[model samples]
Target: YKSGQKCVKVIVPENASIDVYGSGWVCNSGFKKSSTSCVPMTPQEIQKQKELEKALAAEIQRRRAQGVSGDDCETEYKTNAEVCVEITGGDLDCNESYGGDYYRDCDATLRYEVSTDYSGGAYLDVDVECSIEIEYKGRETYSTQTDSSSQDESHSLYAHGSDSETMNFNFSFSSYKEITSVKISSAQCEIDSVDLY
Candidate 1:
């Protein structure tokens, strides 16, 4: 009796063929062996991968040419870029409280002057916040408020060729409590955008 009939059948992997000696399996002509399986990688597939890499590189180069960072601006405008505008002056006007040391019905006007470096013309969206502190009967109270100079929600100011603009904020204290003193504790400005024309 021949033992050949008792030999176990070898299972061939997909996309692969049995070796000439019938001892193992090898990947087909157009496929490559990956671990225990065959993966197809024709000449056309290699060409497509190369094309995709080239296109991605071209996109990065185009954005660099336009002065745009890979992503949007990450920091405040004035700190990240050259400061094209500055607060030249600040004036406060207020009405005296009736028979008290405090003043009410106040208006704070901030003036901005554009630098000569950007004389071409620009639109700026600036946000200003000021902290007001008041003392009443030996206790101090603080408050912060915001106002936009632009017609829209964004506080935009358009300046052309070394121009300047003023922003006004109204502050009124209606409480009948007797206040001792009213003063502006701190003030800060954050420039959102500066678009040059």
Candidate 2:
């Protein structure tokens, strides 16, 4: 009897013995354990468990090599990575809205809206009033620079309509600027595979 079994009675088929008080249960040395019992793990099942553990370890190493943490695997992720594209310049001519606010930054005052449109589609339709600034060097910016010659301008951007019954849409800015991606988790609407520029 082993200590882990804690003095419990040993239960086994005739001529078979289970080590008592052990950290793990196993038949004593020289004892042949019978199969067909659902209480014990079969040899094939044990092998399968080892294989799964090995695969999971390999996956973790692979993710580490790619600089991806376990947290990044979430499909509908929230927080800093959840953000819309950058608003370079001009007004967005959005035809309709389904009630959503697209911000230029994660926590910035600059934002656009998706107007209400019950029309089903492959993409979520929304109206955007994008704002842009004219800088002294003629480059547009979202933030105000100290350059006295800089001026602000805004325009409306309208995306194409769709009836694909999926929350997907394509939008691009007037001026070329890098845009950060976003993930929106809505109780009423489910946005998927959206590409906003």
Candidate 3:
């Protein structure tokens, strides 16, 4: 009996001699000794740990590429409405609304409507009046008009009765290489809507 020694004893047959060295204890099959306990590391468990470490490394690299620091990362995204709206309307119409002239070759129609409501009498006719100016683009080879002359070229519309009246005007010029813009001036009436194709 060895006292005050942390040694393990094994009893074999009486005639058998056992060899014991000082290089720790021998572990049984499928087990390993770690400190005072026998632990095992399965192949599946080792593979899972490696995969987790790889995934963590990949995530860290991704965040680093986006200039993220610490534990927080920022990302930007465009809204669906903005993305959809951009697909339809593109570029601003550069034609001056009140100053310059616009030219169009296609059959362009400027429609004007005036409506009035009389509060005092049901049979009374309310009078409404308005005006609009259509400017046509000129050729570079020809001389352009001054501001005063350009105002003279604008088309005007006048209305009498209040109920409702529609006026259509057509001007013939060189086919419009491009559609510019249309300007409206309203008095005693509101502009309902405008359309250009």
Top-down TM-score ranking: 1, 3, 2
TM-score versus the correct structure, for each prediction: 0.38, 0.21, 0.23
lDDT by residue for model 2 over 17-135, one digit each (tens)?
A: 44323322333333322341123445774565466446646754775587743211212122212212221111111111112222222211122222222222333322222222222
- Between candidates 1 and 3, which one is better according to lDDT? 1
Candidates 2 and 3 compared by TM-score, better number: 3
Across residues 1-197, which tens digit of lDDT does each residue of candidate 3 receive? 34367655654333233323332233343443333344554687456545644664675577558763323111112211100000000111122212234443222222223222212221222222223334433544343221111111111122212222332233334443333432221111233221111
* Candidate closer to the true structure by lDDT (higher is better), 1 or 2: 1
TM-score of 3: 0.23
lDDT of each: 0.47, 0.28, 0.29
Name the candidate, 1 or 3, with the larger TM-score value: 1
Give lDDT: candidate 3, residue 188. Answer: 19
Give candidate 1 regions above 4 Å deviation. Answer: 1-83, 119-160
Error of 2 at 1 (Å): 34
Identify the candidate with maximal lDDT. Answer: 1
